[model samples]
Target: MEETRRPRLAWKIFKLFLVVLLVAFIAAAGGVAYVWNELQPPHKGEMVSFTIPAGTSSRDIADTLETKGIVKNGSFFWLYLKYKGEGARFQAGEYEMTPGMTLNEVIGKLNRGETVKEETIHFTVPEGYTLEQVAKKLEEQNAVSATAFLQLADKPPTALSEVLAGPLPTDNQVRHKLEGYLFPETYEMKKGSTAEDIMERMAEELKNKLSAIPDFDSRLKARGLTLHELLTVASLVEKESAVKEESPMIAGVIYNRLKAKMRLEIDATVQYALPEYKERLFEADLKTESPYNTYLHDGLPPGPIANPGLDSIEAALSPKDSKYLFYVTKKDGSRTHLFAETYEQHLKNIEESKKTAK
Candidate 1:
C-alpha cells in the first residue's frame, strides 16, 4: 500500500509540472504577438513630412508622430524608447516619413538625423514693375513660364481670389487684367511653385497691406476715386517719383492736372502705351492711339499702368497740399524731380534738366 501511494504522488507531481509549462508557453506566445503588432507600420505606404522643432520632448515627438499617422501608438513608442534608453537620441530637423516604415525604422531615421533639406527661391518685384516685367522676372527665377503667366494675367483664374472689392476698369484699353493688382514685394517661394500660386500670394499680400491703410475707404470717397482709379494714380506716382520723398508731391501734380481738365501728359503713360520702354518719347510715340496715352486722354488713364509699392499707394491716398501742376525728372543722376505750378516753369526745368544731363 505505501509503494502504490508513492507512485501516484509522483505521477500527480508530473501532471502539475506539465500544466505549468503549457501555461507558461501560452503566455509567452501572447506577449510575442502583442510586441509584433506594436512594431508594425501604422498605415499603408503613404509618405509624409514633419518638422521637429528644437527642444521637443520625447512625449511630444510621440504625439506628433501619432497625429501624423506615422506611429501606431504614442505610448508604445514612448515605452520602446524608454526601454532602449534612446529617449535622448532624437534630433530636430525636417524629416520625411512613410506609413510603410516600422517603428524601429522610424526611430532609426530620427536617431541618424536623416532630415530633408528643402530649396527655396526668392523673387523680388520692384516698385512700378509692369505685369509683363513681373512675368519676366518670375521666368528668370524659373518660378513660372513668362508666356503662361501672361496668359493667366489676361484671364485670371476664378481661383485667384483676392481682396480687390472693386470691379476691373470698364475701359477697353486696359492692358492686362491684373496689371496693377499684383503688389510689389520680395517673396520667398518653395521650389517648383506655380505662377498662379505666386500671383495669388502676392494678391493676398496686397489685400492685407491695403486693409491696413487708415481711412482708405473714406479717403477714396472724398477724392471721388474708385479703388482701380486710386491704383492707377499710385502706379503713375510710383513710376514718376524715383525719390520716395517726392511721392506725395508727384501725386499733387497729378491731381492738379486732372482737376484742371488738362491732359496728364505723363511720360510714364506714354511708355506704357509703347511696346517697349523708351528713354525719350518722340512726337510719333506720343501720338500712339491708346487709352493709356494720358498725353492724349483728358483724365486718368483707363487703368493702372504698373504695380505700385506701399509708398506710392500711400502718396495717392494722402497727396501733399500743393498747387504744382507739372513735374520732370532731374538729370543730375539724383533721380530727383523738379515740380512746378506753371507750364513755363516746367519748360524751364526741362531745359535745366537737359543742361544737367550734358
Candidate 2:
C-alpha cells in the first residue's frame, strides 16, 4: 500500500510540470504576435509627406515616422531597426509614404533614398542671349521675377564681383553691367531660388569656364584685350556667325578692321541698338544713335552686345590669320558667308548673295 501511494504522487508531480510548460508556451506566442502586429503599418490611409533633415538620428526618424502615421509604434519600429541593424543606412530627404505601407517597404525606400520628386525650374539660355533675353526667358519659365533679375544684374551682389576678371565697366553707356558675364547654358535650379542666386551661379560658371582654358591670362594679355573687350568681340562673332565653323573667320575680319581703323559696322550691333530685333536693317536702322550701334560707332561697343558661347569666346581670343576684312551672308540655305579683302569684292559678294537668296 505504501509503494502504490508513492507511484500516484510521482504521476501528479509530472502532470503539474507539463501544465506549466503549456502555459508558458501560450504566453510566449501571444507576446510574439503582439510585437509582430506593432511592427506593421498603423492603418490604411492617404499618402503623407515628411522631411528627414540632415543629421537626424535613427531614433528621431522612428519617432517622426510614428508621428507622421507611417508606422504603428515608434518604440517598436526603433527596436526592429536595432534588431535588423538597419536605420543606420537610411538617407535624409523629402519622403512620401502611406500608412498602409509595410515596414520593409518604408525601410527599403529610406535606404534607397527614394525621395519625392522635388520641383525644379529648368531653363536654357541660348548661346547669344542678352541679359534682357535671359531675364525674359526666366520670367517665361516662372523661374524668377524678370524685373528683379534685371535689377540684380544692374548692381550684382558683392560676392559676385569677385568672379569677374576685373571691375565692371564704369561707362554709363554700357547697356547692362552683367551682359556677357552670365554663361549661357541649360540650368536646373530649385523652385524658390532668388534672382541673385541664379545670377551668381551663372557668373561663377563663366569664371570656371575661363579658368579651364590653358594660359588664359597670358593669352588675353598677348591680344592686348581686357576681359570686357574680349567678350565684346566674342559677342560680335556669336551674332554674326550662323555656321559655327565660320566663327574664327568672322573674328579675324573684326580684328583686321580694328587694326585698319575701319568701322566694325556689325549688323547685330545695329539690331541690338534698335528698339526691337528686325529681320532686315534699313539704312535708317543702321543710324540708330546708341553707342551699341557699331555701324555708327568708330570702335568696339561700350560692352558685349550679347552673351557668347565658349567657341565664340575662344575664336575672339585666338582668331584665324586672314587678310579678309569684309563678309556678306550667302543666304543660300548654306548659312555661310563670302569673305573679301576689298570693298569692291565685298560689293560683288553682296550681289552674289542676293542672287542666291531663296
Candidate 3:
C-alpha cells in the first residue's frame, strides 16, 4: 500500500510540473511577441504618403496603413491601439509616414495629427463665361474634367437645392441648373477636390453674395420676374454691354423690348444659340430656331446665356428708367453702344457706326 501511494504522489507532482512548463512557455512567447511588435520596424528608410479620410475607423486606418506598406501588421497595430486606449483618437488627413518608424512611433504621429501638407490649386472664373466655357476653363487649370463639370452643371449637386431650384423649371425655361449659379470669381481648392466639390463651393459663394444684397428677393418680386429670369436677363446684359457703366442701360433696353411685345433683336442671343460664339453674327445666325435666339423668340432667352457678374445682376434688378429700345455697338475703338427709341434714330446710329468703322 505505501509503495502504491508513493508512485501516485510522484505522478501527481509530474503532472503539476508539466502544467508549470506550459504556462511559462506561453508567457515567454507572449512577451516576445509584444517586444517584437513594439520595437521592430515595418520597413527600412522608405517614405510613403497616406490619406485618412474623415470618419474612418481604427481598423480601417490600420488596414490602409498596412496596405500602403507603412506598417508591418494591421492586426498588431489595432491591438496596440486598443491596449493604449487610443482606438478612437486617430486624426483624419493626409499623413506622411516612414517605414523606419516603430509601432509606437507611428501611433504617436497619427494621434498628434501630424499630417502632410495638402496640395492646393488656384483658378479664376471670369464673368460672362457660359457653362461650357467655365467647364473648359477649369479643365485647362487641371481642376476638373470639362465633360464631368458640364454634366454636373446640368444636374448640379443636391446641396445647392436650398439656394437654387431643381433641374425642373419654375417660372422660366432654363437649360442647366448651374448656368448662372456658378458665380464667376477667383478660387482656391485642394488639388484632389472633385468637380462636385468645386461646384458646391462656387454655389455657396453665390448664395452668400446674393444674400448680402439688400432686398434682393423683394426686388426680384417687384420686377415681375423669378430669380431665374433675372439671371437670364443679367447674363444677356453682361454679354451685350462690355462697359460696366452701360450694364443698367442695357438692362433697360431689354425690359423696354419685352414690354413693347417686340423681338429683342439682340445679337448676343444669336451668338448663344449658335454652336460657337462669334464676334459678329451673320444673317443666317439670326434665323436659328432655338429658344435662346431672342431674334426668333420674344422676351428673355430660355436660360442664362452666360454667367453674369454682380454688377450685371444688380442692373437686372434695378434697370435704368428709359424709353430707349435699341442699342448698336459703336464701330469705333470704343466698346460702348448707341441707344435710341425710334427706328429712324436706330437706323441713323447704325449708319453712323458704319461710317465710323470705315
Which candidate has the top score in lDDT?
2
Q: Stretches of candidate 3 above 4 Å error?
A: 1-116, 163-173
Reference-based TM-score of each model: 0.73, 0.80, 0.68
> How far out, in Å, is residue 31 in model 2?
6.3
Error of 1 at 149 (Å): 0.7
| lDDT winner between candidates 2 and 3 | 2
> Which 10 residues in a row give candidate 2 its minimum summed lDDT?
160-169
Deviation from truth (RMSD, Å), model 1: 6.7
The model with the greatest TM-score is 2
Candidate 3 structure quality by residue, lDDT tens digits, 201-309 = 8877877878889988788888888877888899999988899999999999999989999998888888878888787778877899888888888777878888898
lDDT of 2 by residue, 18-91 (tens): 99998899999999999988986777999899999989999999999999999989999999999999998899
Candidate 1 local lDDT, 190-225, one digit each (tens): 898888888888888888888898988898899998
- Give per-residue lDDT, candidate 2, residue 124: 95
Q: Give candidate 1's error at residue 218 in angstroms.
A: 2.3
lDDT of 1 at 25: 92
